[model samples]
Target: MKLIYVFFFFCIINQTYGQQKELELIHNCQGRLSGFATVKVIDKRDSSGKQMIGIVQKGALNKPVKVVFNGELTDSLAAFFIDQSANSNPLPLVLILNELFISEAIDNMTEIGRFRLSLRLFIGKQSDQYSEIVAIDSLYTVKGLDVTKKLLRSISEQFCKISQLAAEKQPILDTDAEKYTFKQLHYLDSLEKMKLPMYQTDHPSVGLYKNYKEFKQNTPGVTAELSIEERKNGFRVYIWDEKRKNKTKLPSTGLYAVSDGTTLLRATPLGFFKILKKGGDFYYWRPQVNKSHHSLVPAAYMYGALGGLVYGLIEAASAGNNKWLLQKINYRKGSAAPVSWTTAKEN
Candidate 1:
C-alpha cells in the first residue's frame, strides 16, 4: 500500500510539473500582450477589396482591452514566437472582418441578398514590416445583421478560440524560443517538411481556405462549412459541402500555418456540427455525423470554446447599450518570447 501511494503521488506531481512548464513558456513568449489598441470596422472596400472606411458600432469593437488566455494562466500551453528586429508598437494586434455583400441592383444602389463573412487576425509589433495572419472560421454566413450579432455574441468565444490555437501551435515540445532570434519570414515553409502535418487528423488539416469561393459557388447558401485536408507533410487541402454531398480541393493550403499548426481552427475536421443540447457551444456528432463527419475540433478547440461560451453567457446577461463588448486584443510578428531553457522539455 505504501509503494502504491508513493507511485500515485509521483504521477500527480509529474502532471502538475508539465502544466507549470507550459504556463511559464507562453508567459515569457508573449510577454503578456501590452494593453493598447483602437477599433475600426470597414463598411466598404475599393476595387482591390481593400478596406475603404468603416463606422464603429455599439458592441465589443473597441480596443486597449484585456484578453484572458481562455481560462486560467495555468491553462496556457507552452508556446514561443520569433521577436521583432525593430521596436514598433508596444504590442500590435488587429482583427479584420470581411463581408461579400452580394446584393441585387436597387434603384441606384445595391442591396445585400447574400453576405459572406470571413475573419482574420494580424499578430506582430511592426505589422507593416513583419506580421502573420491566421484565418479562424467555421461556416460561412449568408445572413445580414445577424452576422454582426452573431459575431458580437461569439466575440469572446472567438477570442478564446484564437488564443488557444495560438497556444497549442506553440511547440508541442518545449523550445528556448530565444535561440530563434532574427525573425524568419518563411517560418511556415518549414511546415511542409515538418514530418506529420500540424493537425492530428487526416481531414481538414490546419492551414487556410484556398477554394472557399469555388466551394461556395458549387453550393450556394451554405448553412455551415467543414474543411478537410490530408495530414501528409505536403500541401493537400479540401473543403466538404455537406448539403451538396460534394468535396472540392482548395487551390492552395488555406492560411499561413500559425500556432505551430496545432491551431484548433486548423485541427478541427470539416463537418456540419450541431451545437449540443447540453448548452453552450458543446457540440457532438448526432444528426450531422452519419459516418461522413470529420473531427469537429480538437481538445484545444473545446477548451477555448468553453471559455468563449462562459464569456458569451456573461455578456448576454449584462450587455446593455454597448458596442465594444469585445476586448481589443491582438498579436504581432516576432512578438513571441523565448521559453526558459531549463524548464523546456520534449512532449
Candidate 2:
C-alpha cells in the first residue's frame, strides 16, 4: 500500500509538470507570433475575379487573426485547392492555422512533445474556427501584448528552408512535348504489335479526335493501323489503310520534352507526358515548369532545335523514297540510290 501511494504521487507530479510545459510552449509561441497571426485564404479567387468571403474575427487595424466558416464550407474550399474529395463533416480552420504555429515551434526546438501538447490544448476540443480560437485563448490565457521574439526567428528560418528546397528542384528546360510524342508513338506501336484493340476512350484516341461523336464512332479496327517509328528528332507515326494496302502521313504535332536527369516530361500533340525511371512507365503529358522561367530559356531553345531536326529526318525516312532521301542528303546527292525499303530492310 505504501509503494502504490508513492507511484500515484509520482504520476500526478509528472502529469502536472507536463501540463506546465505545454502551457509554457503555448505562451512562448502565442506571445511571439501574435503579430503575424493574420488569417489567409488559400486560392480565394473565383471566375468573376471576386475574393470569396470568409468569416473573420477582426484584429486591430482591420486585420483578422481568426476565421470561422461552416465545417462544410471549409472542406469544400480545401477540396478545391488540394483536389481532395469533399468532406461532409466540419473541419476546424484553426487546426490548419495552428499547424503553422506548430511548424514554427518545432523549428525553434521547443520540445516536440510540449509543442504538440500545446496545440492539443488550444484546438483539440473545438471543431470550428471561432470556437477553436476562443478555446485556445481560454486554455493558454494568452494576452495579446506579451510578445515572444524567439518563436518568430524560428519561423523565418523554416520559411528559408522551404524556399531553398523549391529552388534546388527547379528544372533546366521545357522538354515535355518531345518526350510525350515519343511515348505516344511507343504506345501506338505496342498496341499494334500486341494486336490489342484500342479502346474508344484510350488517351491517344481521344487526343486525336476533335469532336466527341467522331471520337465515339471511329472504332479502332475499322480505321487505319496506326504505328510509330522512332528517329533522332522525335517519332514518326504511320497511319496505314489496311483496305487500300498503303500508308499515309498524319498531321504532326509539336511536343515539349523536359528532363530533370531522373525524370522525363513530355507535353504536346495529345496532352502531357510524364516518365519516371523508377517504374519504367511512360505518360503522355506533364505539368509545365513555372518557377524558374529565366534560367530555362537557353536549354529550351536547344531542345527545340534538336526536336525539329529529329522530326524532319523521321518524316523523310518514313516517306519510303530512297531517291528523295539521297536528294536531301549532300553526300548521296550525286550517287544513284536503290529503293529505301530494300536498303532499310537489307540493313
Candidate 3:
C-alpha cells in the first residue's frame, strides 16, 4: 500500500537526517531578552558531571542514540541564558539545573519523543544571597520524524517561558524572599545532613521507605506490618497489626512510595509500579503514562501488582527533610541500578 511506503520513507528520512546521534540543547531565540541583570547556571543534579542527557530509539532496527549537550551542560545552559539576555536588567539570577532528559521511541507506527526539564530559579542582589523565586518542572512531547526540529522549538519555548516566569515573579524576589548565601546555605545543608539517621547498608531495616532519602540511607520511615499481596489480576498493600493479628488495607491517599529492600515501587491512586530504569538524575517508570487499562495487562506482572489503574507510573525526586515526591524521569526499556523512582509524566 502507499501508506506503508510512505511510513518507510519517513522512517528512512528520520534515520538518515532527522535524528542525529547526539542532540544539543541550543536555543535560537527570536530576539535577545532584557530581563535579568545576570544569568548564572549551577549544575545541582545527582548526575551533574555527566553530559549525556538521555538516549533515543527510533525503531527496533535502529541503534539507540545518546543525546548530549553540544558542550558541557552547565556552560551550555549558562551561555544559552546569557545569549538570550543581550541587554541585561537589574535582577541578579541563578538557574539551578535539576533535571534535563530527552527520549524517543517508535510505537504503533508513530515516533514519540519526550523532553523532561526541571530548573530552580533564584534571584537577589548577589549570587550567593539569592532566593528561589520559582521552580520550573516541564514536560514536552513531539510526534513524527522531525524529532530534532520540534525538540529545539520546544526548548526555545521553554526558554522564553522561563524568562517570562522570572519577570512575573520579580515582585516576590524584591519583597518577602528569604535570601541565603553560599556559606549560610552550605552550613544549613550540612546541619540537616548531620541529622540523618546513621545507616548501615548491611543491616537495613525492612519496611516501606516513605521517600527516596529514606531508601538511599537504608532507613524505612514506616516499619510496622508492611506486606504486599499478589492477587489474581493485581496486588493489594496491607499493614498487619501485631497485637490484633488483623491486616488492614493500606490506602494510597497519603502514601507516596514504598520499597521492599531491592525494588522501589511508585505508589499511586491506581496501585504500585516498579521503577526499573534511570537516566541522568531520574528513574524511569514502565508502561508510560495515561495509557488505558489494556496497556497494564502486558506489564502487569512487571508493575509488581498494579490492579486496574489507568494512570501508569510516577517520578519521584528528593525534596529536603528526607522527603521525595513526583518528578519527571526518562524512560528506557531495561533493568537499571537501584535507588529511587521517576517517570516522564507532566506535573
> What TM-score, computed on C-alpha atoms, does each candidate reach?
0.21, 0.20, 0.54
- Candidate closest to the true structure, highest TM-score: 3
Candidate lDDT scores, in order, read 0.27, 0.25, 0.52
Q: Model 3 off-target regions past 4 Å?
A: 1-20, 58-62, 83-87, 126-128, 145-148, 167-176, 183-224, 227-256, 259-347
Order of all candidates by lDDT, from best down to worst? Answer: 3, 1, 2
Model 3, residue 10: distance off in Å is 20
- 239-263 per-residue lDDT for model 3 (tens digits): 7787847988877555545644554
lDDT of 1 at 33: 35
Runs in model 2 deviating more than 4 A are 1-222, 253-282, 285-347
TM-score-sorted candidate list, best first: 3, 1, 2
For lDDT, the strongest prediction is: 3
List the RMSD of every prediction in angstroms: 23.4, 28.0, 11.6
Q: Is candidate 2 or candidate 3 better by lDDT?
A: 3
Residue lDDT tens for model 1, 1-347: 44553454344334432231010112332233322232122221112222111111122211011111234221221111222434322444443443222111111111112222344444443323324345543432223432333333343333445544543332212232222211332233233223322122323232232232321122222223444343522234455565758867644323322111222221123421111112111112211111101111221153355433433443354332212110111121101111111211121
Regions more than 4 Å wrong, model 1: 1-89, 100-117, 140-152, 163-347
Q: Which has the better TM-score: candidate 2, or candidate 3? A: 3
Q: How many steric overlaps does candidate 3 have?
A: 3
Measured with C-alpha atoms, the lDDT of residue 191 in candidate 2 is 36
